[model samples]
Target chain A: TLLENPEGLKMGGERRKITILTSDLRGFTALSERLPPEEVVKILNFYLGYMADTITAYQGTIDEFMGDGILVLFGAPTVREDDPRRAIACAIAMQQAMTPVNEKMEEWGLPLLEMGIGINTGEVVVGNIGSEKRTKYGIVGSQVNLTYRIEGYTIGGQILVSETTLQAAGDEIKINGQKEVSPKGVKKPITIYDIGGIGGEYNLFLETNEEEFVVLPEPLP
Target chain B: TLLENPEGLKMGGERRKITILTSDLRGFTALSERLPPEEVVKILNFYLGYMADTITAYQGTIDEFMGDGILVLFGAPTVREDDPRRAIACAIAMQQAMTPVNEKMEEWGLPLLEMGIGINTGEVVVGNIGSEKRTKYGIVGSQVNLTYRIEGYTIGGQILVSETTLQAAGDEIKINGQKEVSPKGVKKPITIYDIGGIGGEYNLFLETNEEEFVVLPEPLP
Candidate 1:
């Protein structure tokens, strides 16, 4: 996209609504502790590489890869009414993509990796940002914090979305459950929904069963 | 260094004693919420760029920059007897460097950034790791987990080191406070010390005053 339209990027910023997606690998530290670093990196690469492909296909701009966590933004460079719907659809695809990733892990005699994705839709400032020496296309706002808080509540193989995301996604969004809770530093209690699937044009769902996180055995002496 | 000593690189893994230094910017989320993303990046770049110079000067290899956190390795590619001492000295220098970084922040009408460093010395596997498509020189061991646990104990402008680091750095390392706490999943309770300074050929100290971290105000509507 940068190749096609270098001039499309605005220098400063304006308030816009964007959907944020954060996915983190469950038991990554366990994998690192028990396996060789080579094995750990290979497993991480397989999972990350596949998710990267899926994220791009969904028109979500990959923001940052923080260790085993992938942060993605949709409707940042350009805002569209369909962004909320697409973000949920993209998340469903990423979850399904994990099947092949875990297959490789199983082949390598490693524990299956489960991913948890958190999504939120809200207004934030997104644009080109930094000093003259270094610049980055980024987003910043209180929404970013809320999204992380929402992500923290998710179990492996689960997709959780904020109340704002539920509203933005409208009636087409399918939900399995909803919980009302107050996150630290938030002004009011908000409802976060466990997403089952989204219907209409993009019909997708996961045949997922979340299990209690099994802690890996402590490293051998 | 890689150009001069390409043959020094080893392919596989071996147990080697290395000093791991992890530094994270305190209140980074607060800064991002209040200021523009550009300002946040500017502040981050200033701190990271300066630390990169000091880390390189001290022969510490930067492993990765995760958001506002910088992960570094000493005695990884090559094991050195003085790695522990150099790591402490480097921590002191990095803390001192924060004064100038804060000055720039004050100049820009932004809040000062405090940094907490965690240092640990232990045996970890260090070598090139990954699949054929992508490779990374990395380390994996329980020590990595222990170091993060120690870092959790530090306040802003403070340096904390595990007991192994205290033993490795020997008698020249001066400390301010020590606490015995059992981190989760650890078999034995270990003492983590707050570092004040280090003495020897590389005499370096930070005139740092550790303070309770003041939480940033909630973002305006």
Candidate 2:
């Protein structure tokens, strides 16, 4: 009965534009197996609950929560001119907010948690998808898929942004050009960068479709 | 094991003031009874999913989803100077957004859903609450209780704001004030108002608190 409704997949003719952000906990599966299920759930709720609040603070919509992972949608359901910037800004805020939250967890004798985030922005179908009875508002496109793949490559506690995101953000943030490497599925290596300075001289690189490489001030421990 | 947590009940400690909004679907039981159980669940997911998005868009935390009802918390997990105002604005947005959503439902040949929203603001303890094994973050206090009680008094498609909420909104909205009426377990008649303008001088007077009256313009027969 739910699938009978055509509205189930219709996008209301709204443009398919959105930002996809994928975040996952580092070593979550291993930790969950080692810890009691109840404790694991409690800790996850406490932390994800916090992350969800921060993302929402900037008009981001949580697309879904999959156990140890979360998908956030920005610039969908509502459009904002600063959606890309807001998505990246939210990534930074999430990183900063986790510090105090981890401290509280440590004080409670719980293991500190780490996260990896990947953000991508592009035009994609945005609307209801499901049976006539149950419909989920979501974004679907290659960008969404690439975001998850990008998240898979992150080494935890780091945020990876796609070239499209960089283009949208323009000069608001500084980047340390990273090496170009081929990501899985994609035919060619995509250029990737590490954000270095906040504001100063043009540490900019030529816009080219090259393999991706990362330049961190210090190697990730 | 998810049941026991040392956190216990998070009674007022986090923020000095916060806003609580409780929304319940009218005639949900009867509506569900008319449909297949699986279809019922699907319909509910679609409606509630949209509501959740709107709430989160304004930085509100969805505490729980009970059947056709939802309890939302604002100003906890994330603190802002104007959480009360945010709650009020969110409620209004929910009401306005529902029109188009319901129209989409009609287009899909699904029954239109109606809900009542209640908003209140005051100091409350906000944190993790439960046994040692499992804990959930939520707000607790008399203000929280009053917020729920106010929800009970709301009718379909109507938003009821407490005197506390009114104080926060100032002259930004026009509300039709009603006499203070005592609710169950509470001794005082809490001053409440119909959120949007009903019509004429005021929306219909309940005459008796238990009676419901529609305030919208006359509909074509």
Among these predictions, the greatest lDDT belongs to 1
Query: What does candidate 1's lDDT look like per residue over A1-221, in tens digits?
Result: 32223223335555578999998876676556677655555555566677877887889887766556778998978777888878999999999998887776777677888898999998776765532333456666678778887888888889999988888886778788999989976889999999988888888887745534566899999
lDDT of 2 at A145: 64
| lDDT per residue (tens digit) for residues B1-221 in model 2 | 22233244232234347788999777665565455444555555566667777887888888766556677877777778777667777787777667766876787687888888998887665555432333456544567767878988888877887888778764456565565768765667788887763223222222233344557798899
Task: For model 1 chain B, give the 10-residue run with minimal summed lDDT.
Answer: B1-10
Docking class of 1: incorrect
Candidate 2, residue B161: CA error in Å?
Answer: 54
Residue B84 lDDT in candidate 1: 85
Q: How high is each candidate's interface RMSD, in Å?
A: 8.6, 13.6
Q: What is every candidate's C-alpha DockQ against the true complex, given to 2 decimals? A: 0.11, 0.02
Please tell me the TM-score of chain A for candidate 2.
Answer: 0.82
| TM-score against truth, every candidate | 0.77, 0.46
TM-score of 2: 0.46
The residue-level lDDT of candidate 2 at A181 comes to: 57
Q: Residue by residue across A82-184, what tens digits does model 2's lDDT show?
A: 7887777777777766776688689879888888888888766555533233345644445676788778767666777888887886565866456575776
lDDT of 1 at A43: 58
